[model samples]
Target: MAHIRERSLTHPVPELRGHGLLLRPWDAGSDAEVAEWLRGVSDPGFQQWNTPLNPVTDLAGARGSLRARAENAANGLSASFRVTDASSGRTLGHIGVNEIDRTFRVARVGYWTLPEARGRRVATRALVLAAHWALTGLGLHRLELGHALGHDASCHIAEQCGFRAEGTLRGAMFEAGRLDAFRDVHLHGRLATDPAVDLK
Candidate 1:
């Protein structure tokens, strides 16, 4: 597989409308918003969307995470972004495509919206935008999203975006609080060829 890192894509801010949201790259410096958003996330199920970086309880930690994200992008691994209100541009959530494989044109997509952002069709719009960018702008063939089976909301988002449910993983995650963290996630995905998948 040719490494996706070799593709060297310039992250583009994608525009998605019709569902009252916009999906775009995280601003050059958005640590404050990142930290504040993380703090506001009080649900354990939603928090699983992030990697197991040490918990960020302060702005400094969020800054550190942003720095690390830049480093990762430089190394050819991930690209992250924020989901916002199209009209107001208020940061409502964050999402990203990670573990990119250029040869296969595959990447793992993940995201979570604020509690206030939930049930507003924000995630659905953001995810579709990400997929559109991946399959067209980035020339990717496959996009995958995995969510703990228990997190029905996330799974629902993936499905609503036209990703077909694949299967479940077992004992693949360790969540916060030693709470029997197992990945056991249901995988949802689409290939660029699927007519329903927005490969535009």
Candidate 2:
């Protein structure tokens, strides 16, 4: 697998601008931002939608998470970005493309927003920017977005970002519930050939 640093040494991760948001590489020096991200992930709402996951309990865990993200990006396995407020530069959320299959020109996208960022279409805009880059900048042919069944907000975001509903995978994911049971997943995808929808 080609590392993102190798690709970035040639073609760096582009700055993606959106309405009221800016998607950029995660900053390694921003302890406050990292802490905020940990808080967001710790939110019950966020945990509910994105679960069966380890929680970042403290500064050390947060640093470990950021380090892992950087290493993944450096190795080309994934590209992660921090979604920030355009004006104040407050960290609002995160979005990333993972499971990148260079041979197949495909990847899976995921995101999470802080409680204060909810209902603002922050994730939707970030998704558009990331997907656009994946399709054009990365020259990927296909992109996939999946969410646990019943997560209507995620489904709406995927649809608004031009991904078409594909199908459902039964017991495809696990959520951090009482028993950590597997849950059905709703899949959506977009092809590079798909017409771009006006997000304005």
Candidate 3:
């Protein structure tokens, strides 16, 4: 198989502001950010939904994860951000556009909110903010999101963010637990031509 190198982003990822949230790059040095990520990855709900594949066991691993996120953005493979409360500067969640195909102008979006931040529509707002930036700021034409079939909350966040349910992929995702176990995933997508739904 031939490897194709796509054009990378020329500029740095910018900070995005929303109604009550701020989307900023992950801070590898911030204690609060590290603690928040550790808390999130430890939550049962987050572990089930995100299926991190590998566990983040300690603060060092969490910081390493953030560093890797920065490298991915630098290489233009992905752009990830920590969603924070604008007023308190507390980490609320995270959202990102990964698996970028610059040649095709497409990417996959993913997000997860901390337990303390759930039920407040944090994921929806963060997703909307990131998707808009990808579509407009980065000039990407398509963005896709997928959730486990039974994850109603994720589906709702996708829909509210203007991503239409495209279909399902049978056994497309590997859920943690049993070896070689996979779960069905419901796919959703949004195009550049799609009318942006108001997040306010």
Candidate 4:
């Protein structure tokens, strides 16, 4: 047996193009940009599901938090990227791979699309690319995709991307505000080694 160094990797820092959608990592000093996007955006659907970043003390606080996680890839933590438009570079949403396990070859998939980005099948395309990257570039074995029990669009996106339902985890997550207790979430998952017979 030998100890192997986990390969240091960088997420796609490109203007990813898929089905007319683009995704890229956040840029330096994007705090105001990200924050302003959140300003006055009233969508309970987004808030209930994704916990829209709020109570932002200042631009510095927001940037420091997001950037610190990106800088922590040397560890097993997670990092997120901005889902945006290729031509105009407008922010559409967010996506990330969390619960990274190098030794175990596993990670959790998570994403949220802006209300404007929904109904366009944009998530399906972005997630397809994410799956391709996760299974091939990241060398992951299994990926978990979870969502609040009532979140249908999220579940649909996961299933459309080939992730299979794995039953709900009772009291799995904590809701925001008022110190809410664990809430049930529907669990879905997929494995990299799932049969490739269809590949031509």
Local distance difference test scores for all models: 0.68, 0.82, 0.84, 0.65
Residues 1-200, candidate 2: write the lDDT tens digits: 11122234543455677667778777656888778767877889877877636667777787778878878877778888899887998888999998888999999999999898899899998888888888887899999999999999999999998999999999888865534578889999999999886677
Task: Please give, for residues 1-200, the per-residue lDDT of candidate 1 as tens digits.
Answer: 01112222354333444356666555437665766555544455465554464665666666677667666666657777677786898888877888888888899988877777777777777777777767776788999888766888887788888889988877666654455454566888878887654422
Q: Which pairs in model 3 have colliding backbones?
A: none
- Candidate 4 per-residue lDDT, tens place, 92-185, comes to 7767777778789888978767777778766666676666666766788998998989888888888877889999999777674324566789
- Model 1 regions more than 4 Å off: 1-18, 28-31, 40-45, 48-51, 179-183, 197-200
C-alpha TM-score for every candidate:
0.80, 0.90, 0.91, 0.78
* Models sorted by lDDT, best on top: 3, 2, 1, 4
Against the true structure, what is every candidate's RMSD? 5.4, 4.0, 6.1, 6.0
In terms of TM-score, how similar is model 1 to the real structure?
Answer: 0.80
With candidate 4 superimposed using the best TM-score fit, by how many Å does residue 123's alpha carbon deviate from the native? 2.2
Give the higher-lDDT candidate: 1 or 4.
1
State in Å the error of residue 137, model 4.
0.4
User: Residue 81 error for model 3, in Å?
Assistant: 0.7
Top model number, lDDT: 3
